[model samples]
Structures are given as C-alpha cells and as structure tokens.
Target: MSAPAVGKRQDRSGPGTSRLLAVHLRIADVLLRLVQLHALWLGWTLRGGLVLGVFPATAAVAAIARRDALGRTAEGSWGELRRDFARHWRGQFRHANALGWILAAAGALILIEERVMRAAGDGAIGVFVAGVLWMLGAGVAALGVLVWPLAAHFDARPLAVIRGAVVLLLGRPLAALAPLGAAAALAAAYYLVPGLIPAFGVAGPLWLVTAVLLRGGALPAAPAAAPEPR
Candidate 1:
C-alpha cells in the first residue's frame, strides 16, 4: 500500500512541477512582451517631423517611457537624460506640433496621388510612385507616435527635425521599412482572419524598433575619429 501511494504522489508531483514552470514562463514572457511593446510603440508613435527637431530629447523621453512601461526605475544616467531633454524641450514641442501639419498634408497627398495615378492608367510606374508617397506618409505618422513621449519631454526646432528626417530617409531605409512592413503584414493578416484581433497588441513594439532604426541613430557606435599628430 505504501509503495503504491508513493508512486501516485510522484506522478502527481511531476505534472505539478511542470505546470508551475509553464505558468512562470508564461508570466515572464508576458512581462517581456509588455516592455518591448511599450518601447516599440514609443518609437513608432514619434512623428518624423516632431522627432526630427528633437531626436536626442525624444530618444531620452522614449527611454524613460520604456522604463516606466517595464516597471523599472529610470536608473543610472537618468538624471543626465532628464537634463539633456530639458536643454531643448520648449523648442522641440513647438516644432513637434508643427510637424503634425506636414504629416497631415503628406497623408492627404498620398491618398490623392494614389487615386489619381491609378485612374490615369499610369501603369506600374504610377503604382510605384503612389506606393512611395504612401510610405512617406506612414513614415511620418509612425515616427510621430513612436516619439511622442520624447517630444513631450524634449521638444526641439524644425530645422533640427528636418536634419534628422533626412538622415533617416537617406541613411537607414530598412529601419523605416520594418515598421511599414509590419503594419501592412499585420493588417493583411488581420483581414485574412478577423478572429486574430489579439495580434494587434504586438503592433506597438514592432513599430517602435522600426521607427528608431529608421531615424538613423540605433546603429552600432561609429569609430572614434583618428587623432591628429601631436
């Protein structure tokens, strides 16, 4: 009787341990996903125009937002980050809002261009141009949202934002493409099976990484300049 009971106890214990481990992993994964989602959304939401004039400040604020989302302290160099944001905040905010107008116009143009191009029978070239314009609109809108917290924290000037936008456009095309592709793919997938509404929850983080990388700052550190002869 004792041996039979002992074996039953061991068998039950194995499943219990497995269940505990599985639950812990699910919880951990949820937490990590939450963190990444927030960070990525912050990056995606940052508008190109707003982020343009205030990249450094926006980056700092986005970092803080990421920390908050993760339930972590803004530790280690946080003070410096705050100060850096403060240095250019007022101007950044002004320009950030101003850039909103540009985004709106771009969106309108993308719509009109696509419609006109398709109607005019411009062929593949027209479709390509329409797609490009649409992409630009996406880039602008996504950047704004991704960098919102940063804009709120470290507003900057218009020219500055333009400079940043140019760098992103000319230098890091793939970064910009990632969020757009993700958004398109997600939308397509959602349409294919409307039952998967839960998947949209992941959109935030996907956009964030894309937005940041597109803005041309997330690359590995550049080599230090060679020193001149003493």
Candidate 2:
C-alpha cells in the first residue's frame, strides 16, 4: 500500500514460515526507514543523500545475486526490486550487531577529520558541510572497496577480484575526495539526520568487508598456483 502502512496491517497472531517471512519483511522495512532517516540528515549537510542512497546501487548488485540464488526474478520488475530490497533490508540486522564497532571507529576518525578541517580556518559552515559530504561519499565508495570480495562471496573470479580489490583499495584515498567534495553540494540532509546519516556513514563497515574479502583472495575461483614446476 504505502511506506507507513506496510507493517501496520499484518497480524502477529500467527506462527509459521509466513510469520518468519513477516518478521524478515518487517526487519527489511525498518532498515530502509533507518537508511532513509539517516540519509536525509546527511543529505541536508553533505548533499549526496547519505550512504543509504548508495543502497540503490548496492541493492542492485545484491538483488542480482539473490535472484540467481533463488532462481528467477519472477516477481515482475517492480516486484523484483521490492523483494530484493526487503531481503537486503532484513540482512542488515547482522551488520547491526557485528559491524557496529567498525562504524563507531569510523565515527571517531570522522570527528578527527572534522577537527582538523575546522581548525584549518576552512570556514565553519563550509568545512562542516564539506566534511559531511565526504563521509557519505566515502561510505558508499567504501562499499565499492568491498566489491572485490563481494563479487567473490557471490562466487566471482579470482584474478578479477584481486585486480578490482586492489584498484578500489588503492583508489580509496583518491575516491574518498568525492564525498568530501559533495559537502559543498548540500547541507540540508545533515541537519535532518545529524550524525545518523553521512555523519556516521558506512565507511567503517565497508572497509571491514573489503579487508576480509581481500585478505585471502576469497573469490570463488582458486587463487592461481605458484606457476607450477617450471
């Protein structure tokens, strides 16, 4: 029906796969709401619409994987998008528990960045605004940081993942500047969500995932052998 009415109409007075499904569905819904609320704030300040906006992109990739795993995106075009979104939403609970530390650490780093930028006489409004956008861009681009193992976790190739992971990781310092640049684009979102959005963006968790994925060359294919016995 509508965003607010989604979980409202469901009766919790039942038990079965339907109930589990309902729980998952609700979890997914809440996750999106969180992302939205978070993004809105960052959007105001940073102007890039927070890391959650990147959800559209991340969800796009994840949907493809889920579609492959479950066989067919039979839910029609719109239905497919909604279904994948719900699944991705529900999946964040895992991140909530496990990835919280990473996010917290990232927050500390951002604050440090904030103080440094602010002290440099970059103009309070300008630096604050710029810093927020930087966080948002960094969070999502950081997601790209994990693209290597993410592809692998979904059974991507070895050489490809290695090459891509290196590119993303090495490129991180440079790529991070976009979010920093986006700050000048807008500051309205930051005001709304405060630290929830771009302030406490997704960079930390993404970095975690990227590191894990790249460490062992976790791509689906076996890493190439030591060029055999010559």
Best by lDDT: 1
User: What would the TM-scores of all predictions be?
Assistant: 0.42, 0.29
Q: Give all candidates' CA lDDT scores.
A: 0.50, 0.42
Residue 225 displacement in candidate 1 (angstroms)? 22
lDDT for model 2: 0.42
Give stretches of model 1 more than 4 Å off. 1-65, 68-96, 119-155, 174-203, 206-230
- Indicate the worst ten consecutive residues by lDDT in candidate 2: 221-230
Q: Residues 1-230, candidate 1, lDDT per residue (tens digit)? A: 89999999999999999999999996675455444433433443453343443343343344443344334433345345444334433334445446555555666877787788888886788878878877876666665543343333223444454545556545766755564456667667767987544543443443344344434344322213311111
RMSD of each: 9.9, 16.6
Task: Please list the residue runs of candidate 2 whose C-alpha ends up more than 4 Å from where it truly belongs after superposition.
Answer: 1-77, 100-104, 113-230
- What local lDDT does model 1 show for residue 201? 44
